[model samples]
Target: MGSGTIVEVSDLFQNQPARLSFQRRPVTEMAKIVDIVMQHALSHPNVAFSLTNSGRIVFDVPSVSEYDDRLFDVLGTQASGLIPLSVPSEDENAPGDERWTGWISSPDITRGKGDEVHLFINQRPIASQPFQGAIRRGYKTRLMQGRHPIAILSLKIPPHEVDVNVHPTKRDVRLKHSWRVLERLERAIAHTLHSVATAPDSNASSLGIESIKETKTETETETYKKPSWAITATQQLTLSGDSARSLEPEKKRPISSSPAIQKTIFGGKPIAPALSSDERDIHRYSGIESERPDSEKPLSEIINELPEMEPLAQLADSYILVQSGEELLIVDQHALHERIRYERLKEDQNQWKPQSRISSISIELNPKEMSQLQAVSSTIKSFGFDFDIDSQSMIIHSAPAILTTSSIEDFMRDLLQDLSEDNQRALSMEKIKDEMAFMRACRGAVKANDKLSIAEMRRLLEDMRCIPNPWACVHGRPTAMRLTIHSLDHHFGRHG
Candidate 1:
């Protein structure tokens, strides 16, 4: 058991071969060697304990519980870096089952030969094709095509759900929900890639984009539409004011003698007795019809209704300048439009019940793709699509009202792509729904560079105010940002 001791041992084939084997040594010798190795490993608390031949011990002690820290310590000077991740649980009820873990170096936490990594799920380390594939996919962005990053992930899930009996060494575990776990892991890794690769930190220069100020104006030539009831009400109110004044008695009249004379004089206007009930009914009907169109109006009318602001010239075809008292307000046309569209879409979604319309054409998809679609059917339904899968093809019975005129094929394709992306992660249904809604809103909204009329700009502002998150777009990009006059003055060195 200790040093370079050679002893004869029987082989399974019963062949005589010279092999360095541990003979049935005295209990004292074995115990002494075990004590020495354990003491050595215990001394280096940061090192992983491993016993080698000749009674030697090799080990590494991890710095912290995080995958990256542990990996850095284990690899020492040879280690490249770490990709830390925390994958949230897919189940709503078992929210605590989220995995706070990552992958680690496998002797070769690098790109060359003997390069390998270890994956631990639920604290019980294990290696599987899908699990490893998930890690590879997640690091696909950071590392070169063939080169892989040395990573250590410590996955945390409900211990009871992971069966540790799958391997003799207990380095691998059989997850009860393999796909769900793998998807979560993959998403965590992808997110890590995005954060590392896409982040625009403070060091980057600004885009030099300025805010736009919306200047609302009313066209004098455009006649404002007045409903019949409003017209009638205005006329009646004016007439009532004149009649009430005229009918007031010049002085207090004696009630005894002049009652009949007062009544004749005080009576306002004689009712038009010649007009029959039928004629009155006809008049009412015409008034109702005339008012209906003006009452049930589109948003454009509402925008035009606002008081016109003084004309302010456009700057660089983006910002609209408006003077509010001594200060100038500039708005981003794209952000304003995005905010408006988001609010309108959200309001429409909440206020109206989803209405389905049957499609004449049936959409076809493969089984795996269909399964992915079915998984996110509720999310799809929220975005105003009700899909039914039949023998030959999938039928889109109804779509969102906004998408009514859009191509059904394009809608299906986009929906499928979204579903596919979501399926790659163990995301909550709520998160999935939000993502789908945001995607739809972004797709449907007016893009930047689209010219807007002054009235339209005003309407956009009104709509933006109505939205819940007006400061940012649906995807979390800032919709509009403000720069105070003081800051502008300081930039020009006037404040100094």
Candidate 2:
């Protein structure tokens, strides 16, 4: 027999004509190979690894004692920003059998895709949803939606307690007690991140927000002031049961369009003059029809349709508290605004015209993102986004009036991801527009912790009431929660 049982196979899939016909892009295939090799190499730290690309050494990893050393070698400068994670013996009940260790990137050091998350079980690289979800749960509110943290996780579980041959590619593993393991991993990551925040290091501030020096450009410094009108004061309401209280309408001055004020009303959304009625009707025949015939109905009519409620007060600068009949309504200001914006975008899309040319904005895209954008460039242009693709960048010559420059990149990235996933390339014209509108609404809506005045808050509530589906946001999340007076009394010892 040949030494080491050397073997070579040629004419791959020769007998399978169907499989040979479906050819994957070279870059895509290479990326999968790189990912697989990286996963195996990261787990097997004792084994040295080298990657060659077209006769050139692209990446090299030397054998090392500690896992973090390999991470540093692979990620290079990027690894310096990561926080080391370890579980204390007291915190881990099965420390000997189910050992865990890893390094997690800080919130600022994030990726647009989940490719950076490399998880291994018992020194075997595997992809486990529970593991990924657990890591995400650990980060919780620290990361923004659509952003993924770069992490390297190693779980040393007993071989008999896990099953590895379930998946076709053996990429996943099933643990005997997965829920408990996931929970432990999540807790460990959270605690590690917390410790990093409180480590008294100059690199990170409290709450794990990065402490870095930022250079502000002229465009960043220039403030765009949006003029907002306040609504007439609503009826005052009283809170009963625990402690009786009455809210008085507070008079506030005209708000300046400070960064804080603009961020409060809408995050990164540009303030532009309203489009004319004729302008809005340009896309009427493009499969998008107005949801209501009375689209131009008076604002007062919409407000009148809402239940007779008294605005009580604002909660945590994010929620509006209102008293209606015997129920107390807790409205999420952000979600409510998102629903309103989504409806408005829908209306705008129906009237969108191919000839409409908004100001052009240059957006920088990475190689992979750029390729994805190029793939669906024509589809995007049909939605009123006229862009010219360049190497690692895109120049938009025309776009919808509602899209903000700062948020255009994020919007496009999210759109490209949806279109590129699973090779589902065929999409209807209306569906594309709808997806774009949803992304725009999500990005432009007011974020949490944005302070709003009593009048502005009341106007927002009235606006939300006008939407077709005011109960839920665009993402199907509940916009408000109602607590009945009886329910409140039952919670306490008074009614029971």
Candidate 3:
């Protein structure tokens, strides 16, 4: 009968020595316990929480209205950088079982390891890849490779809709609509981060940056001042009524000016004499010179040739800035390069032919690793990996065309680990090959913060525009974003 429930285990695994033997060291066990306590405390700030180690108090937090205070107490003073995340209230159309709330760190706050992230479901701490991926997808490109953002995500779902008994540790759960949850979480985090990025920072705005103010006229219509950078993309247009009207010219041409022109006429107006055969041919082929063939044309020419897009400056050495017509385009150099590489790989795959004489390489594996390899051996063979396995080790005779000698071992190991985790699904050779291509693209692609010349940046932009899926990389990360004049005007209060 107390308000709180207490769980205790006595003579744990006494009947199962194997289970006890598999337990981690005491120090590691203690760390896990502390992690569980910290997660629960952080998830439920309304409850007074305390943790102790060997009769000594580690942390104590009284009940508080704000979770930020509790976070500081648990995660140390550095937790101040974490941004409070609030998902929009579920709409009437939203599933009643779906609920998510969390706090995400700013782009400035990150960790080399993903341990900084804590996920909870129904006030219970969970360790699920889908949940973790949701957080990563939310942070998206704001964080760099190998660096994960700090987050504390809390989720709630209807009991009937979730299967919590899927994992022995109760960390993994099966959601009836897992994709919906992930999509919602990602959208909420992205919206918050976007708002923070676009919002004027107090310190920066106070440092002599001119502030744009919105004004209302007698007609109650909101008006904004024109942005200073409006002319940066192209020649500035004067909105003067007379000048604007004068720019438009009337079109009048004689029907017989060309033989083709004579084909269409409203009335029997005076038609000029038909041109000579040579002249008619000349006129017929006049505009043909402008039509560029796809094979011979450059990428810029293929994409309508954005002559007005003058290269401005690169941002953070990662995003290339170019003025396109009246819009500013920010292109992610790494993502752009990755997409290019992936497309090249795809093209190569289409033209791929099996090798006549495949070379062999020997691979050594421990017993555990060997077992893992055997489990996925058939899948590996289907992926163009010709190999022979024995009790102790395995020898690879041929490898995938996409993989190199140096990376093959690591690639095989990773694939084995993945297969060990998910054995039920039949592995698709195409999927495996695509993943290989993705890895190669990631490794060979340009990295962030890498300097580039103006010509190089322009070339990359041109290539991106020519690609079918130029907006995102192979991994679905955004490669470029266009900031329009309207958005800029709105941001700078230059609207009417």
Candidate 4:
């Protein structure tokens, strides 16, 4: 009506109360509407986009000549941490094999949620499983399980090369000469990951952490500098034998914020905007939380079931080494905790819930995430989270007692994305419950580089003796490995 284009919608469900009853919360609806605007904003970075809800300026990002600048406008300081990517075409004859230009965050700059990887085609937002899978394939072994990197990549090709009409929503499309495109894209991404690392560019099988790691005993006190990428040392480690060990935190982490690529901040999500749906079906469900029939073993009995693995030392502050008979058992602390949490959750439905406590923090939401949160609100609440929503924004009034303010935002976003995928399919209640437990355990588990006492390590092993699948975590990664004396003797040429 004035100098610029103005689009407005008045009453949405004026007379359709029945239909309105089936709709999501007002805030969720607003998020979905705004999400459409944001997608168009990312896709058409040259076009100035502004949004208003109830006269409040939700965002007013100006047009920018460089798409990367637009990224800074929409993604805030998070854009600066990303590595610029330029993928060359593999072959001239192949369609959609044209070079890709975009930015992707490194493995350490990851989110608890998998929804941030945004992909596009020909300057239009489009989703393709093969493309998303290729991106993940590039990040393989580099990232911790359940953590996702933020990526915004786009492909350029003739419009005919991609069939956008395949999906009703048009977000997903069918591509021609896809295998060739995927192969090159995967290799390009993998090569980029390798090239960007500080160490020798190799697809290392065992990614030995180069960062400093420390373990403190109860009698010792020490001070250390904290890295920006380090996880909080919040867990209370188990004591060895009778006495307990306290895992005190530094309380303050000198988290270095990335410099802003541009002055304009995008909705304060320093990361990216909005979450889209999944690229594939639930990966390796394998009835992760199914009930296993086992004899009722007492806690002491379970602890004693396995051969005594006497606590030796915490290796590299990541692995725990123990002595059992003439063998050495190397246990991955993070993986062991993940499996322990998963088993505890699956053993009792009540274990899925953490103690609830009041916490007041408001979070900005992208429309897709808002919709997903609304879809799985019940399941989310079951895990001890409570939120109040309105068209203006959503405020968290309560959360699980185990989560700190620093982690609540991340954990919530992660669960929203994971549960949203589960909701897309017609899964059984058991399957859905199990999936939620799987994410909960993964989120709550201790991470690598976390310091654990010898006692704590022994307690974890003892707990593992009772778990049904103690060999691997819920993600199916090996938790512990053994090096028997027989094998060691053979290597040393010590024949009997």
What TM-score do all the candidates reach, one by one?
Answer: 0.34, 0.53, 0.40, 0.54
Query: What's model 4's TM-score?
Result: 0.54
Candidate 2, position 83, lDDT: 83
Once fitted onto the true fold, the runs of candidate 1 whose alpha carbons sit more than 4 angstroms away are 1-311, 350-358, 370-388, 404-437, 443-447, 488-496
Once fitted onto the true fold, the runs of candidate 2 whose alpha carbons sit more than 4 angstroms away are 1-9, 21-27, 44-81, 91-95, 107-115, 140-148, 158-161, 176-180, 198-336, 346-420, 423-472, 475-496
Tens digits of per-residue lDDT for model 1, 170-252 = 75667777666665666666555444432211111111000011111431111111222235544632211223443564347
Q: Which is better, 3 or 4, measured by TM-score? A: 4
lDDT per model vs. reference? 0.44, 0.60, 0.59, 0.59
> What lDDT tens digits, residue by residue, belong to model 4 across residues 1-496?
2377766766867877677777665665565666667777888887888877678666567888988888877766567768887453333333443556678877655665555777788988776455767777666545544556788887776777888898798887887867656665665666566566522111211111101111113433211211212325784432122233355654445633554422122123423222221101121121123222122222344643567678799876668898988988888777777677666656664543454545477766654565566666776666566788764345887764434455465556656655555235444446645655665565445665567766577677777777677777775666777777876666556886
lDDT for residue 359 in candidate 2, whole number 0-100: 62
For 153-245, candidate 3 gives per-residue lDDT tens digits of 887788788898998989888988777777778767765675564332212111111111111132221112122333466776442223434
Report how far residue 116 has shifted in candidate 4, in Å.
1.7
Q: List candidate 4 stretches off by more than 4 Å.
A: 1-4, 8-22, 88-97, 198-409, 416-496
Give a tens-digit lDDT track for model 2, residues 161-208: 899888888886778877667767776776676555522222222111
TM-score attained by model 1: 0.34
Q: lDDT at 433 for candidate 1? A: 42
| Model 3 deviation from native, Cα RMSD in Å | 20.3
Alpha carbon deviation, residue 471, candidate 1 (Å): 2.9
* Model 2 quality (TM-score): 0.53
Candidates 3 and 4 compared: the better one by lDDT is 4
lDDT score at residue 30, model 3, on the 0-100 scale: 53
